[model samples]
Target: MKRMIFFSAVLGIGAVSACGGGGGSSAQPIAIDFAPLGIPNTDQEHVSYKVTDKLIVTYSDGSKKEFPLSYEVLLQSGDQMGSYKWGQLLDVNAQPMSNIAYTKGEISWNPDANSLIKTSDGKYFIITHFEEPPGMLYASELDPNTLKVKSITPIDFSSVGGTIINCAGSQTPWNTHLGGEEDYDLNSIYSVSAGGKNPAYVQCTKDSNGYFTGNDVNGKSNYFCGYVGGVQRYLKDLNIDPSNGYLGDKFNLYNYGYIVEVAYTNGKWDVAKHYITGKYTPEMAVVMPDRKTLYMSDDGDYKGLYKLVLNQPQNGFNKNWCGTLYAAKVKQLSDQNGGTFDVSWIELGKACDSEVKAIIDKKPLLTDIFDVEDPSACPTDQGFKLITEDRINECLRLKVGQYRSSKFASDDEVKKAAAFLETRKYAAYLGASIEFRKGEGLAYDPDNNVLYYAITEIGGSMADGKGDINLPNNMCGAVYRLVLDQNYNAYKMEGIVIGKPINRDPNDPDYQKYGQKWACHPDYVANPDNLKYIGYNTLLIGEDTSYHINNMVWAYNVKTGKLTRIAWVPTGAEVTGVFAHGLVGNNYTMTLNIQHPFVDTFRNADGNPVNSTYNDQNKDKRKGILGIIKGIPAGLLKLTH
Candidate 1:
């Protein structure tokens, strides 16, 4: 009965009329016992050490302190892993150490704080990387009256080599730090810029795609690393063969998605590709206050949302490259299974002519197209794998709204509105399937232009509500927001509902004529009276290699739209357990990211703290992890909405 009214309002803990619904069998009374909104992480470092826990140290009594050991604590203790030579952080008794100054117990552990930005002189750097094997990208400096983490500066993924995997970046229009690159035969796009005035270590090239020949050098391509002031590099083209316009194209190497514009002012490092794509895994790349349009976020598997319209016009650092890519049309698909949720949209001119004719015929290889449901493998051993159709059309591209219909019509209905995109099926039911519920982070609030998403869990909640995992919890993950109907603000799609609509009286007997698509309740308690609950969103509940709720993003309020919460940095701290994420920076320091931590906190094998309890009977538990409250600021996030 509406899952017994969402388990009597999430096991009655977060109670509020137990959220309504389950009021029948003589109203099933007495069974209350609630009280869980904090405390239970038990803290002790979620047990034993190393493999993945991606760094987290947030305290102020929302309580959290866990460090699961990494790089085996600089090789199990006698610490000193330096050698940046000229960019600093030196040692072996040589000196030059304000970058990572330790000293109290330098042997055990304490290097868990993965990505946090704010440079340009406002200083707040904070990037970490080390699950061992030379994976270094340290750089700390915080304190602001006890925010702790005083000084650190490591930087060494083998001086920007291969196994550094992925690291979303952004802070340039000429300030430094760009970093980019992730898989696709060993991606590339680095430039820490150390101390500017021409700092070096560049990489990016492809006029002939031998995949850059295992890091070739003598032909001028050991992936460059030298030329910052002249801007001679900013790599990652992957394999672009979209019918050759040339810049290298092994059948467009699945267009390897977007973000390419390496500018370092007159001295060197001026690469290109700034933005151009067919969609799918464009990864992070942000630039809009008209820095000539570019706003990406597609960690593939059709998680949706994108942008890149600049073929001309320029601003900020000036580097424009051809453009015209826009994806995001699901129009409706929110079902929940009590059987009535709503929003079945999908037409954007037949989903951009079936994603530019599937990236212009062929080029799909992300481990062999579709089927990514891995609740821990073996439904016959996990499906929809990838090695490349450019990682299966960059995992089904999506940006949001209007799948088709609106060229201002007329002209006699423009060839039946382009042959009504051949009776659409919503990008083939989200590209043949995979919603094992895992679509992390994605925010765009410019003051309530509304677009906050974070699906962690939406099925288990009732042993009196606080962290209940009883089963039958399908409706997958939750935390949604899609409002845009201020009278259809230029029709990106109208009043996308989220609550308030259980009006039944069409002459009784359960009428239901398309007017009921959920919203009568899901914890959206009427505010401007249209269903709300956008605060610190959630959904990842318990076990799956160890408790979850990876990368999450949200920041809205363009004149009172409210919804803040963006402080993510997980993926088992870069062990790559998924939740990929995007949106980098430029224009004097920008931030909203996640990547790298290889381990420093996250436990289970009985050690507890995989965000409290979790499954596997507690797998070596060591508990302690849960902190929220740090959202709103970017000068109130770009003014007007």
Candidate 2:
């Protein structure tokens, strides 16, 4: 019956009642149809392109002009297949700098928080590297006026303590950078020399006896990247052992998964983990207008969209890290590919900073004298130190609430263990929806109190029998939006836009023969990753696709319901790090990255060269940055929610 209601609203395109339940039948009604967003993305050149059809956006009207972008390359990586002398570098006054550093790829423009000492006399930027030894976060200062690099320095995370494979982050209203690592939930970095002025990390393979060994480097053992039994995911993932701390073993595993707020407040860039925001496979964080409320996304299986309300809004994360975390449970009101629905938040747990710190303090000693090779010790010994025991099981034994059993003394212990430790599991046991995949990038409209998020894959959570949803499986992906109550809690949740696979041929491997199996467009926007809202209810969708698509960035107007392709990258790459510069005005510069493109010039199957992406100016062909500044159409500026 609920499925029928959702289908009536979504697939049938029925309207949702204020009561927030499906009352209509699941039949496609002959309703209004909007034109397609934009034409297929052109090559990665700074030229004007056309929209697919006569793009008539409701808000911007059919007359909105598409402007050409004038870009600037701040810094490039120096990896083996790198370009330039080592890609490229520009000094403070836009002058070319001679001294070069490492190949730091996924980039973010900084000065997130005003620092006392200038790393560079101009603007500050940070970049991250994946799969590289001693994964690092580098700061490059650029002249504000000319936007050129003045100096470059590696940020030492030891003071804050953690060997972070620094990934994507969001610039907070506090002027801080809250960076989140992918696939790094519950992983620990415990080597004393992990992340410091000069850091050393271990890369190791585990033994059957619950121990990890790394190659000898300079007479010292390399650090372990995974917990004793925790999975060692990938290059940029959390691989360090939990017994090993991030900066030191006692520094702990609970330290890594939460948002690491990197701020420049008292002269230097400092990092502090905000554990109040229940940890998961974190991707991005969006602060509501109230500042006290935050919307965070998790990019992992069984991940759920989360919201947090701080005890004090005026007191920033550095001082006050006490808050209540909630996971959204959607009651599907619609069933369209990009339909609408109501959402209710399930309170998972609450925490204070000091309490979480104590958990981290015990991380190193989370041990039990368990016999090795005891098959019965599997789940029980996972999180403990045998080397490491399954502390997760110990925590499980302390469960309370609906999941409580003979293992726990009270619900407080269960909440405490699950609050900072097994966040996802804790939420799931509370009946919070844990059926999402790749939920990343968040944007919100304060005036309307609506939050928009990207669900990169249209499977798992949306599968049959979960929520009783009956919408078509979008092989491409979709953007979901939630309308929040005044308290910044979700009252409704639903899809707004869906991805459709394009440009298919019988010869293509992705072609679904009987139309049963399918893949999205390889050159179009699919598997939407990062999202940025540029006023007037316009949401930008960036891609991190697996469909072999030369990923692209798109703009979806909430008012007009149009998905326009604005930017694109080359083969073997994902469109990452889309941030709208904080400059106030009608028109502003949007910073973007063409991350990790193919080192060599790519060619199509017909032996034709793919020229637009390759930069002939630099020999090595490395990743680069772009700045896109376009005018907001007149209609868009005067529009309101």
Candidate 3:
């Protein structure tokens, strides 16, 4: 086993020289080394959670200490070890909440993001986010010593509408949980081109005459009605009927895609969505040390990288969600590796939550914001611009004068509403680069004044040899480091780590030698999704990829550029909820989850199907796991501050 070493200087410590020549001299710097786990490439190894790493700490006085790296399975999917079962749905009052029969069973087992928080009153809680159509959040009170779940209660979002597709999140500097909603539903609602209707949209928007109206086969009128269908389905899943015309009475498309914050105060939990962050499908939102600047990753192809700078910086973000949203326009500096770029901010207007929410209340459709025309019939002689957004090409002109409805007070109001409601389209209309593919997770390093952003894949518009981002296709993806200035604005981005692509043919010589058949090298990171900067020059990266047979969790030393495999998940399972909780009690701990095991399939080098050996207590392959790697020494994770 190859060992990884961490160095730290012993300050203000002097010792007599061994040669007895000098009276006193500064002691040598101490080094802490650890053995890393091996890569899992074989059948048996692919279906197991393996962590064979150990930490050895050496002192300048010739003394040494060693601690074995071990993980504890805190909660597994479907485990009824607490008041509420792991991943189980519960109402705000701790009562069981029902779901539709088809999705009820599946939503109870998918756990994505985990935020371990310590309150000012010396209480500890873990906030877990469930990724589903109508996403949910659950808070569990933990016994600080044993780290066991004492009680569990689901955080209600009924007041702030409802959150969907809750994915990766981060803990705020103000000691609150900030979660994300990956709202792909926006893609279906705003699709306007012919033959571009989503099947789910077709099924959801039946007219009053009991016929599908907003479908590609039929004339595409009322395409926004598809969003109503999604809300109706979510309500039905919650065992609530929408026969009372709840779709028209409530529910808005702009309400779902913002960052949600969950804070506990006065013995109650409060939830609020940051609408000022600009609505989009966010994978994760991470705040800089300044507590006002935020970087959010948009999780799909041809999406834009967003940044929000809160107006009232001293008051903090949670207190005031009002901010200015900006999109990144990149200039490719180099095409080598995964590519590097010079980043410039494109101001995408400014608005508060109240201002944007008032516009959403009017229920403005796509046509209300812009006059849409077919791509071929675009009137270039007029003021129409041909733009492609969400894979649909259309000619759009901002609605002004008497061209739009009487809902807006002025044309300025219409533009302000479009800035927040149709964020990606408006950014594109303003000439901002909206061509990033699979932007996943974000991590900030306060000491270094830099931010690390993860790109799961480098294909799609990113590699199309046009526009702002033009690079070679590397489906294995890469991680880019952005250099931040004093004001928390990023000026340059460089690829620090890039994955290696390999031949997936089972009969290939490389596949036979590596004992695996996958699209990416098993040793390097494939589709790096969730990231956690655990101080001491280390960043933990979790994989969410089908390209790699067995997904892995790696610890990369940013200073030394050393990548070490720390853990592995079962076949077809993604390593999610990768959080580094520093110095919980006497030990440093990290939380990670295995989500949706066996949901995908893998093949061996011999072209034989490989199945997972992971059998939870329920003997089901569809379950997930929420675990913690405990006993990490404080010496291995000393903060730079």
- TM-scores, each model vs. reference: 0.24, 0.66, 0.85
- lDDT, candidate 2, 291-320, per-residue tens: 688887877555777788888773343744
True-vs-predicted CA distance for residue 32, candidate 3, Å: 5.8
- Poorly placed runs, candidate 3 (over 4 Å): 1-34, 56-65, 81-83, 90-107, 188-230, 233-247, 314-319, 504-509, 603-619, 634-641
Which segments of candidate 1 are over 4 A away from where they belong?
A: 1-211, 214-250, 258-277, 283-355, 358-451, 454-572, 575-641
Instruction: Rank the models by lDDT, top first.
Output: 3, 2, 1
Q: Write down the lDDT that model 1 would get.
A: 0.26
lDDT of 3 by residue, 520-581 (tens): 77889988988878665678788887777777888787888888887777776777777536
lDDT (Cα, 0-100) at 326 in candidate 2: 86
Each prediction's Cα lDDT score?
Answer: 0.26, 0.47, 0.67
lDDT of 1 at 568: 27
Q: Which ten residues in a row have the lowest lDDT in candidate 3?
A: 1-10
Residue 632 of model 3, lDDT score: 50
Per-residue lDDT of candidate 1, residues 1-641 (tens digit): 00000000000001112112133322222111111121112222222211222212232233332322112111111223343321222222323322121111112122221334444445554443221111123454444333333455554322111121122333333343333232222111122111221112233333353233212233453312111100111123254321222223322222323333333344323333332333333334444334445444433232334444555545435433444444343322224321122222322232222333333234322211222232222143322222112122111111112322232223222221221211111233333111212233333343445443433333322111221112234232333454544421211322222222223455532224322222122122111100112222221111112222222222233334343332223323211111111111221112111222223233322233443222243432211111111211111112111
